[model samples]
Target chain A: MDVNEKYFKNISNRERAIFEGAITMGALFHQFIGTPINIKSAESLEKSIKTAMELQPCINKVEIEINRDILKKIENEYEYISLTGEMLDVKVESNFSDKSAVIRLKYISELKYPLMYVEDVD
Target chain B: MDVNEKYFKNISNRERAIFEGAITMGALFHQFIGTPINIKSAESLEKSIKTAMELQPCINKVEIEINRDILKKIENEYEYISLTGEMLDVKVESNFSDKSAVIRLKYISELKYPLMYVEDVD
Candidate 1:
């Protein structure tokens, strides 16, 4: 059977925000908190995120952005990163005219610290 | 655990279109076949669609519109409706500026026939 025919079964659209956020966070968690974060780790995280977010209905494309160098630095300093302790700020926005929905997560109050933007194409 | 934390674990966003289309189709199938088509059928289809779609990430709202009378008319004459026989035309459009994605399915060739539009808000 086709993939579409198998999934997207019965969830509500509003809940997608949380879904996307969690996906992005999972990617970030995978990229960081590892044995020395690197560019490859970043790429892997973004790839995972890209693959995950695009699975939603009405989402034709997904674009992600993150600063790997900064992320690596933060990861090295901390023994572990906790995503569940309100550690990250998440935002979900849809630009109708642009035909895209952006899911972003920010860590650290500093300017241009760590941000992940997942854009969905319809 | 949260819904987002639980679901949206794994799935490519691009596949989401197919995922969404199938969900919409399922709803349509339920509303049209083996019964006297009515507004409730359309409502059920749209509602199912909305609930299913909103479950995706970055989707804030879902708006659905369908022609019930037209669908009911088509149902009265046909013994069985074949959806897999290249029967329906599906259109998925994203208006980024408007922050929405519109999924429309048309069954008839006329100017106005059985059409289902499921709009997603992010």
Candidate 2:
């Protein structure tokens, strides 16, 4: 059975693009948020997250940038901090048919919330 | 700034409920997927995931069950295995005003995908 035909026939291509990207963006945030990390481990962690999330359906790319500034200031006894939404800047690109979208997760200081939104669509 | 007024006014209450629950469900899956786990740490990991996800906007509660059968059989060199979506069964409950939704993530063997869907709404 065709997975998309069975599970995703209701939504339009644009909506599917958004849906897939949203799921991935949400997945990226929650999946990596509590991993132990310092400046030294940041790059490897970022790479791992990118590779992992990209495996999801319709996901073409996952770009992650963990805040190095936050990692640099770590003074805890453990010498590393659990990752948080505030430290993540992410863009997940997904496509369904001719439509595609980029979903972004970024910490917005004004609201003090990590905001996820549709950054681009086509 | 009024976050709901500014960022969430476009979606209906039911949509917002589904959206929030979906996001939380995705976050829950990704955030803890790679954590080192064995039967001994499964309960603690489940508790931690539930507590952390319950803090998200509109999310009322989170329920997590990590597969202990898989953990019990672990024979890896490290004595533990990284958490994977196949090992998780989760529900995220979210409400926006009178609208509420429960999003679920469970692995389906036929699809070979950990599916996320709106399990319930009211």
Candidate 3:
């Protein structure tokens, strides 16, 4: 089916279940493989999702938000991709009062394991 | 005071105040400067305290925990000292089930700033 046609086709309950299953599997793969995996430069989220799907046949889509400060730090310090799926949300706040930086992660869903330490790419 | 003499000097209430002041100042300096500042390999904790004291009149001593797995990753990836005073505690757990790594940090005592993203020196 064409992309639009497939998307417009009213998703059945069974199809939805299957899709949820895939996401669950993706979450599982992500749990096993590790989070914040490098999907930044993989053309598009669709492509990245595709890559993830190829690995586990379950992930249908993906979302990402790049922290420029983190990206800059990573670029300045290291040469590896920084990725993590276990990260539900991230907030970077620069403290002018104290002249410091704070990175906070709130409520990472499906974090079956403890937080994994990923090196900044800079 | 000689080493033993100073050691035996019963810590008075006033002296305790002074010491607490120093720790509070160290905590402030740690806030202004950033956390996890490199204190390792400065000879000893006393030396580390000395170094911090030199930088700021308020600081007295410092504490640190080195995560070896993180150390290895840092060593393998880049070259910089990994330090964070804001880091109150650290727990590193190897995930045999998922074949991954997990690093957890408990509450940091006097974190005046947001979390400083420090590069790990491997």
Candidate order (TM-score): 2, 1, 3
lDDT of 2 at B67: 86
lDDT (tens digit, per residue) of candidate 3 on A12-110: 433543443444433533332212223354235334543553353223333334333443443322233323333333222222221222233332334
* Superposed model 1: Cα runs more than 4 Å off: A1-37, A72-100, A108-122, B1-122
Q: What is the lDDT of candidate 2?
A: 0.82
lDDT for A104 (candidate 2): 79
What are the per-model DockQ values?
Answer: 0.02, 0.34, 0.01
TM-scores, each model vs. reference: 0.26, 0.71, 0.23
Answer with 1 or 3, whichever has the higher DockQ: 1
Which candidate gets the maximum lDDT versus the true structure?
2
Q: Against the true structure, whose DockQ is highest?
A: 2
DockQ value for model 2: 0.34
- List, residue by residue over A1-122, the lDDT tens digit for candidate 2: 77677655555677667667877888777666779999999999999999999998889999999999988999988899899999999999999899997877889999788998767777
- Tens digits of per-residue lDDT, candidate 1, A1-122, equal 43222222333443343233333343333333333334445566556556765553444445555564445455545443322212334443433222444455555344334334343323
* Comparing 1 and 2 on DockQ, the stronger one: 2
Task: lDDT winner between 1 and 2, please give it.
Answer: 2
lDDT of 1 by residue, B22-105 (tens): 333333333333333344455665566567645533444455555544454565444333222123344444332224444555
